[model samples]
Target: MDFDKLRESCRKISMPPEMKSRIKTNCKAANADEKQRSRTDGRLVAVCVCCILLLLGIGLTYSGIFERKLPAASDRADASKAENENKFAEILSTAKLTADRIFETTRANIDETEMSSKTQTQSQQSTESTVPEQTTEFVTNPFVFPNGEHAANTGSDDLSYVRPLYLEMSNRENLIIAKEAAETMSQEDFDLFLAENQSMLQGGYFHSMNAGEYLEFTQREWYIPVAPEDMAEICWMYYEPTHEKIDLGMDFSETSKIRFDINETYKADYYYKDSNKYRYEKTIQRDNATIKIYSRRWLYRFENFAWKGYRMDITVCGQEMSAITTEMPLEELEKYLEMIDFVTIKDWLS
Candidate 1:
């Protein structure tokens, strides 16, 4: 026999149908066991994986590694964290507010600077465009007096001039003493004396009072009272026009004028009526730029209770001496003249 064939046949004979079925069952059982073992092994691997995941979860929760971040506690770290956040927000807000304020302030400063620059530029331009104002001069007309002795062009609408009346240095006591020594007269006689010197008393041209004259103080018809009341019991007066009016200029605003400076001295002088009476001599010096004129006034009191008025005599004594007479009512001017300052005349001239 062939040993290999024999062995194969023997193996077949030993494997009976029932026995084969049993063997098959045993093999199936063994396969079931293997399957069961594989399932068990898979379950153990799943369990180990689950256990590792659970431990990792536990560790993460305890250590706060993979856990949800906790909120700050109301009484602990959460409150502190919230306060810090609020402070940080406040700081940020303050910073932003500060930045905004700085921006606004800078913008306002720029605007103000621009406005000031514009205003200054406009002012400068206006000043440059404007012109300075010029002063105007006025010229007057020429007028001649009927007397033909004087003429003037005052450089205005009319002839305007001022003349000194009288100057004296005697005191009231001296005046009283002089009044006692002079001649006596009545009020009626004094009135006639004033009427005779009407031209001088009214400060007018000799021609007007003489016969027919056009020159006057206001160039209008104004009259001086013939009889003016007196102030003192007796008083002396002196008045004179130093020189005849001369042609000044058509524009005499800047012109140097003839001014009279009178020096009055109180001394014992012989009067025409009574030599023992006190008399005042006023020496007046008049000057323009080219020449000087001299005039004199001598005053004497006429002692009369009834005729206590002021009597004035004026005369220019270079070539010849002529007496000019005028009178004033000292009584009417007494109140005003008492409070007047003599130096005020110099201030007015200045």
Candidate 2:
């Protein structure tokens, strides 16, 4: 047969469907095998070449061309082998490109996922940092009356008598009371008294009196005395009529008396005797009682020099007496004493 006729005859000689399917399956299996498997590229190429030669040999023999055109058949088989090798190379190149594209796409997806996760974590941390911290306040009243009740509410008004009393007792007038009391006692008795109350003497302040003494003053008929229950109210009315109440718990007994004393001496040069310029005095005349108030600017040498301060003394004739000292001005001091109602002995007697 001629070359063209022989080639056409080879093409017409078809393999069985089973054989074709088996060849496709083997190729796919080889490609899909583990990288470490014994199957290599060189081995796969040799197998393909052998399969092509076998098919050509079978076709030439079946067509009766093997014996008559042996050399020509050999040449055609070599050409078919070269063509198969080229097709296999092309398939391998296409597969490699597809694998590289898949790897790039997968890497990009992984990177994006990781970046998104990091950003979310940072955002949560920032939110936590911006959040504010939480705080607390404590308020207390320290004045208590002899009856175990709070002195904060004892007065008619909201002001407590403790602050004013404390201020007044801290003055040089305390020394005057001490001197007057000293005059009544003999030197020996005075020394004994000082020895007995050494703690209070050294403390630069007077010891508190008992409930009996406090009651004695309050029960007096000559002047109006503030009842323990009304002490806070009265003091409040006198001072800070419009201000809020601040009850600083002062240590005192219900029957505690109003006493004053000082450890150091005060000179006359320190006294501001100008009653009008340095003092605020007022008289509140009631139907049956007259309330007299005298608040004066007093100076004491607490440190190196004289420090100006105020003292308030209240007297209800034939009724009662109350006094306080403070570093506040006369105007402010007046607020603390104005609300007190002085009742005379005649009024109480009636």
Candidate 3:
């Protein structure tokens, strides 16, 4: 058959309504398939969109740009890190505070210990000082009595009780009269001679020829206030004239130029083997604001039996302070006297 005739024959063979219905059914099925395909394409697009959003969220979480619900282990690790950091900071702070406190306490303790040691040392020293030393013996000078009275000399060998001598020097005044009076007396006659002539010498005159006379006469004589007349007599009795006059002496020419600051002067009564009364001198000094007082006594001896002394005191409240004493031969004593303008005269009236 020809191709057109073959197609006509096939169209004639089909059943009419049933075949049409089946055809419609088939067309419907095709349309449904097409709609299904479009819906499937839309669903595929939605699924892709959901996948992209999920991927973006995952990326953000990985980069720490979004909060995430952490697994238990991750949460524990983060918490542990914070705890360790806090612990480290707490330890450092506690250590710093403790070190500061320890340092301060240690410093305070050292200071307290040093102070305690010093105080203990001072107390120990004070305790040691309270006891008197057995080796030290204080022998008070008998002449330097607390009551201001001097002890009398009994001619005993103990001369420690003998008083010291005090003198002041200045320009000459009425010393000529004293010089004349002192020259006239002999060792035996000194007491009477001094008794009569002591009035001629007004300033602190004592008749004696002991070592002190040579000491004083040869050195110098200065004007001092007169003591009691009995004191003068006692001194004259104790001092006797020598067999030969030692010409070595100095003049008391400076008596008027010198000044005096008298602190204290005293006399002590004494007795001898022959019952002749005698006396000794004592002087004392006191301290003032700007000056110190000094005390001394005139001591002279004609013989072992005859001895005499007079008290003298000087103060330097506004002046200088110096003391000197020495022993020399009779020749030197005479020369010292002559140098000081003390001239020996024979005639009492002249």
Number of clashing pairs per prediction, in order: 2, 29, 36
Query: What tens-digit string does per-residue lDDT give for candidate 2 at 1-350?
Result: 49999899899999999999999999888767855365677688899999999999898779886466445866865764554455434433543553354335434544553454445445645777432121000011222332345433432212332222232233234434444556666443443443333222222321122111221111111111122332221121111223332221121124221121222221111122233553455766655355554442221111111112333343444453433334345565455334333332232223
Model-by-model lDDT, in order? 0.31, 0.36, 0.34
lDDT at residue 96 of model 3 (Cα atoms): 51
- What is the Cα-based lDDT of residue 283 in candidate 1? 32
The local lDDT score (0 to 100) that residue 276 gets in candidate 1 is: 30
Q: Rank the candidates by lDDT, best first.
A: 2, 3, 1
Candidate with maximal lDDT: 2
Output the lDDT of residue 108, model 1: 51
Model 1 local distance difference test score:
0.31
* Candidate 1: residue pairs that collide: 72-78, 73-78
Q: Sorted on TM-score, highest at the top, how do the candidates line up?
A: 2, 1, 3
- Write the residue-wise lDDT of candidate 1 on 1-350 in tens digits: 69999899878765568998999999999999999999999999999999999999888788968756566545555564454455435434544554354335435544554455445445655777432121111111111222322222211112122111222222233423322322243322322332333222222211112212222222112222111111121122121233233222221223311111212212111123222332333333322111111111112112111111222222222322222211223332333223223232122222
